[model samples]
Target: MPVFGIFVPPTIKRLRTSLYRDALPFSKNLRLKRRSDVDPMGREVSSEDSQRYCNVPNLIISGPPGCGKTTSVWALARDMLGVQIKDACLELNASDERGIDVVRDKIKQFAARKVTLPLGRHKIVILDEADSMTDGAQQALRRIMEVYSSTTRFAFACNQSDKIIEPLQSRCAIVRYGKLTDKEMLSRLLYVCSEEKVEYNNDGLEAILFTAQGDMRQALNNLQCTVAGYGKLSKEAVYKVCDEPHPEKLREMFELCVHGEVFQAFEIMNDLYRLGYSVDDLMSSMFKIVKQIDLPEAIRLEFIMEIGKCHALVLQGLATRVQLAGLVGRLCQTQSRLASD
Candidate 1:
């Protein structure tokens, strides 16, 4: 029978061997190509020395969504743990089964088994979205982790590490992943386009990055969506796929706000609402514009404060239209006061 929806052991073992042989070398080769003095967590690990510490540890990989936390874990498992070693791996999403029973039953059952691999290797249990687990569940998990430390290694992936119990945090090697830079995201997108043989414009790729805001996975997905919808990638095509307001429109809106054109700003806000942008989306776009524009520091600070208030209202369940209108009105008032002063 399947172990908590995981594949049957024999079938998984068979598939793992072939996949490990074929895919493991790719990661190994990629690592060899880079002469990085630091590992992914920003720790200094000489290329030669890194190879010596290839053994996987009980790790907690934390980062924003689409930032490659989970990807790094799989790479470590494949590259460091050897072929067919994943058969001894168990992947769980703590968000899906957050009850203490899962920790007491499913996790305990999986971790209790000895490694099927040779010596100097370990069984890996990857608990994704681990921050979502209840405190009670986390407490149970902490004890289980101690009990299985010798036989099973745990890799916890989460967007926020603070939500994970402190005891659990102390037991693992924490690896922090940051948002990908635009240059890094663009390079990866170009690689994908080349491999898929999809033609793309440079400006179109930049547009995708702007929409993704440092999310590598989101950038790639946006690229694919644009290509699928338009049969190629262009700036206009990407904007259409994302359904985001044109940069010119955003510029005009900000200009109106700065010039104290309250009515015009409200009109633009309404139009954006009609165009299917949510209040949160509008606020996010406005904040981005605020950072880029050349404005008096005082005015910029005031704008940010207003945006924060609007966001707080949004969180309190105020109507989107009301909050946005109030934000635009407040911006106009601030501009008027600054001008009069």
Candidate 2:
């Protein structure tokens, strides 16, 4: 006969002892305290618990692109969840995975899961570009919000809050983020340069600011591009990255238009276009230059009105070249009329 081996099953008491032993280290690790939570700038930002709206279950943050809405959400999540943030937060881009399916499947599944941490804070679901979701998806989301309000909180970020359903909007605290001020932007740019050890001139910084138009993300990106391409930040490098006409050249084109030199102005515009400047960029630069034009009040007003019309056309999907050429022709007529007067 084959040798027989006797096996003894573990007792409940022994099993329980082993399970507790294995879990002891995990429990200790979970309770380990973090030293400090600081932002990128080394500032001690307030935690979510310290915020007045921490009690709010839902939030809607509306702002222009690159205005720090998403960054603020990240900071808030970090503050609330600490080391558990990555597992406690779900980030979804509505523009990318839009529709009721995502809201029902991914969002619902995540929200229904039991909280893993004992921090007493609800899990966070961040929906970026929230306004991009369809009406039906948004409607479905409203129901999910109701069902899971206790276990999860939502932070919706969008360029426009009006696109969200009224019921959904009413259920959340709406916060509007404004564009960064010139001073704030400049300070941030300077800080970046110091951190990167990149050489930059004031003119170059100003160029980036002007092109960015209060968008911090855009400003930083332009700065990086300028530095990477030129190995130094200068006004010319910034302009090159922006693919914008030089201020002096733009001024020349404006003067040509204002003086009824339509041919010359069109030639300049064509050359700039060939050089890769976008029509939108040209329009923006012209608008700024026109405002500073030293012309009579009536002429200035007329120019503003005409340019405004052209801009509206451009926004309406009119061919850029056609609208720009028409704008130049109108400016020529206006200048001729003013000269006669």
Candidate 3:
């Protein structure tokens, strides 16, 4: 929970149970196998997960950006007695050089540095965006973790745990976080609006929520920018401030695709492209809108898969209007085939 506000999810209640359980005592490290299990949020929870994670000294906390992974560990470090969190915790983020050298020099040195702490409270070295670290660095860090298991604890915060090396991941418990619900985000937004005297209409807030896609930091940042740029938060203002492909226009385009109106959909894509939006911007917006729109289940899934392929191409530097046009054409073909069948 931030000093400004709290939006901890229910899955985190289980973590609280683990955190307060035995005050971070490690009886013995579990020699678990290398597993590719997705985080708790990626799949259903098991009763064993709650019990197994409490005593693990090292943790691989994975989630989307702004989902409170880093904050949770900070809160834990703050609550410890007999040591200042600033002194006991070694923090590294994406901006830092996270190569093999840093793991060998910086993190290793931190673990070896002697510091007194409350019994069972080990010094924490937090690596934010651990997925960005090099494989060699992760390998080196895993060895350090094994060597220094008694004196220090390691916490790796990342957006995707799968990128972590298997040997390293095996030694740490995996914790997954998900995006905030819309209702939770809205309540917080409304509170902020009242506190800041920010005038916002429902449509404006809804746009923020849509653009935010469950990331609180993005929502708040967009909200602030909208207020700064427009003096008030309205649908048009938020959209203009954020400046992405508008969902309403994308929805109109998608409806055309559903009816096999290829030229119409391409016209919308061309217009959005001419507005200076990237192909990635349009493809992602299309994907998000497709999830909630009322369409036949088979067609919806096919559309999403095609959009994903186009998005991949966009990421690979083929971010042209041609890719967008091709994606729209594919969606139209699917709908035409479905109608014929």
Candidate 4:
């Protein structure tokens, strides 16, 4: 059962629209820019310049991890968009030293060195994590991208488009993706559950979703692992399998905080810390759980803000049970003030 064939993200339509826009007039525009030093080519061009001249503008798809950027790219290239992937595409990860060199050599060479292709086809080099390259490497890209504009196009996949240098960013058509909605994720999870014929309660599914945080790969992996170890999926089994703090306990902790029961909440927090979970795991899990806790909207926002601050501090290397206790104390204090008001 191959599922890749049917994979279409919610953003695929938008992607196709950006990717398939009319070819800009490359030669005519370059000819105009040629008289002045407007572009790297004697081609006077604005980074925001429009075209069908050299080729389609290179593509940059930005999104969070595991949101199907990779799948979407492959699907568009090999399945839906009729790209001859074997010949016309070169895929490389641009997150490490190897990528930098490739950016300098392989990508540059691939772009300049021409290959025969069907009419209207251009060679494509996909640079995953294009933003991770050093500033110097990216500067190199500015020239390489321009010089080879007529023969090849580069597709960049990055978690943050802002990290991409502006000149490169402007010459590219950008497509952004967001996390999958719970409804969308649940639908896919249900399909997986049915196809796998795994026994799972509703709570079991929810636990998977909670742990996955909208990542399909993580959700599927959690689902598979839960089934493999426990024989059936339950909320408890999922928590055990993922080794994440149980949401039930976290809910109880938050409930106590809302009731202004600081001592009891702190006790639960202490017990969780003693259970061998890292300080980061504790704060992160609580942060996620706090959002789902039934609380007054104002209280919810305050709680989130406080938890965010604690998480930030923890990330800066001050992780400790004392920090967690202090965060709990403040959360409880917030609830107390709300009650008094």
Candidate 5:
């Protein structure tokens, strides 16, 4: 446990334990791992407080969506402030319907002199999707940062830091977030499963990690989506109903279909369906495949059109398994579909 000297903002500190974890997009297992669990990656920044290092400090978190930028910031705040006034944690999504002026006004009110909370000496602002802000809005934001730096701290979160003005970038201690590793992601998911008393399959767990691509939130969300159908978790059950198909399994299935192993592909789809995979899940897998295959416009259009049909089926309440099986069957037959073109 090397110390990362980045001080947790007080607003995050004030979150109730339950709310903080619930707010996270990860599975129950991963959430549990956070309690008294150590970060094995040793990526913690153990220098001086982030405030001291970043002038007009703005943290630019770049990673895939669901990689925990927003949640991590909240966790940092919770650890710093204490679990009472997490509501004081003001968050504004620059991508939202509210314009920048409204956002600016909200910030002013939140940080106003009369708005004292029970915890922490100052206020914290989390500006989500900061890259979406217009140039005019950013100029206003720059002023806010300077005008209120004494009483407020800002945590700006975005998918890309390059969109931010360089002056703003220079002013903030940029903390680049990486994807959650398999071990860390698994540890969290397992902890949640234990609390929920879900029986899980080892293979299913491996599949989740492989497909999650270092995004803990997606891993957890997919897990929950799959398990919600059965109210119980098991590898076999997960495989059958899983909407987020494992990438490797999906690749294997595609190989079978493209190689004209119709029987084998059908068998795989059947196995997946029997294992509880939904039609929607299978369709989703096909979509991913189409995106990967380096096909000509004619082939791409044919595949996309077929995928669109399956997507429509999923929307029409077709059983998840049926939808998936149908997609695979159609993909296998698509050679003729293209030949007709």
Candidate 6:
């Protein structure tokens, strides 16, 4: 198996120079490129991605879901092709079909065919969610790569490369990626807001990033949802749409449960539901509240145990409306009971 690492060929260096400088014989006017192709400040390739602009064609991009792995690589391909990317590159989602034959067919087309201009400079295949491919599919891919080394360049995008077969791992240069940093996310968000000309409050961008958990797609989607509801955007609107209710709201619900207000507690739970708070969200917040107070270990243990039971019931499909309501009531009651004691 060939070792996996970036080896920038001399040809790529010359080509890169020619594309950027006007003095170069092949250099053309840069005014024709679309704004979307550049970054927020109009640099050609994103600074973070320029390190990856070297000559290594077969590449593996690993990162968590929604970190913009798919988008970044496609952008690189688009820049390389010097045209709108349509058929010159193919993106395959491994989880959708989960069959090796499907991958084989696509690989055949990507490797064997020659795409005309206005598509790309060279043919590229982006295997999105590549880690989801079955062992059979991966084995088939290994065979395919051996057959077509020059014409087809494969880029595998996955959250974890450890899940990929070693043989397949050895065949490509791996680019490990982490979640978008706060600055990077903000940069991307500001770009979006500026382009759409959406009116935004000072904290609105922070609110989007906080709730997105480092996923660009999540942030983008939340931004869209906020815009849809508020017409223009504001921090409060984002908080509301994201269901990032005030801490007081959670405390109120906790208080209702603690006082043995089973019916009222149930009502609060309904409100949370209407507000789109998921079960995970409710449990996570409840856990945080329990952690804040210095409660006795034994008592806290008991509460944790009960909460775990309720969580399992909810997840196991055994929970009824009454049962879930009762669980919430118990959790709220437990917290208040601890406070009093």
Predicted model with the maximum lDDT: 2
Models sorted by TM-score, best on top: 1, 4, 2, 3, 6, 5
lDDT tens digits, residues 1-341, model 2? Answer: 23576554568659977777544422121221322321332222233544633564588889888766776676777767878887889999999998899998999999988878654588999999999999999999999889988778899999999999999999987888777777867877787788667898889998888888878778877887788789998998998888777777877877887778999988888888788777777778888768765777887888889888888888878847878789888987887787789
| Reference-based lDDT, residue 256, model 3 | 92
Please provide, for model 5 over 160-272, each residue's C-alpha lDDT reduced to its tens digit, 9 standing for 90 to 100. Answer: 88888876787687777777777788777787678666678788787677556677777777677667776765565565565455555666776766656777877777776
Better of 3 and 4 by TM-score: 4
Report lDDT (Cα) of residue 335, candidate 5. 71
* Weakest 10 consecutive residues of candidate 6 by summed lDDT: 23-32
Displacement of residue 158 (Cα, Å) in model 5 is 1.4
Per-residue C-alpha lDDT of model 3 across residues 1-341, encoded as one tens digit per residue: 56777888889988887667524211111111122111211222222532243343577888888665775655445544224677788889843677888888888999999888755667888889989998888889888988999888888889999999999889887888888678767876787788667898999999999999988778888887788788999999888888988889988988998888999989988999999987777877888899988888999989888988888888999987778778888988997787788
Total clashing pairs in model 4: 12
Q: Which candidate ranks first by TM-score, i.e. highest?
A: 1
**lDDT minimum window of 10 residues, candidate 1:** 26-35
Question: Can you tell me which runs of candidate 1 are displaced by over 4 Å?
Answer: 1-51, 54-56, 116-119, 261-264, 320-326, 333-336, 339-341
TM-score of each: 0.78, 0.74, 0.72, 0.76, 0.61, 0.62
- The candidate 4 region of ten consecutive residues with least summed lDDT is 26-35
The predictions' CA RMSDs to the true structure, in order, are: 7.2, 11.6, 11.3, 13.0, 10.2, 12.6
Which is the winner by TM-score between candidate 4 and candidate 5?
Answer: 4
How does each model score on lDDT?
A: 0.77, 0.78, 0.77, 0.75, 0.66, 0.69
> Better model by lDDT, 5 or 6?
6
lDDT of 1: 0.77
The model with the greater lDDT, 4 or 6, is 4
Q: Give the TM-score of candidate 4.
A: 0.76
Q: Which runs in model 2 stand beyond 4 Å of their true positions? A: 1-54, 116-120, 255-281, 291-300, 312-326, 332-341
lDDT of 6 by residue, 1-341 (tens): 23797777889978887666634211122221432553442222234443344443577878887665676676677666655367677788888966977867877767777666432245678888999999998998887787876556788889999988999889887777777777877877777777667788768887787677677777888888898789877778887887765444666765665556767767877777667666656666566555444556755675677778877776777544565576776765675667778
Q: Evaluate model 2: give its TM-score.
A: 0.74
Per candidate, the number of residue pairs that clash is: 0, 0, 0, 12, 28, 5
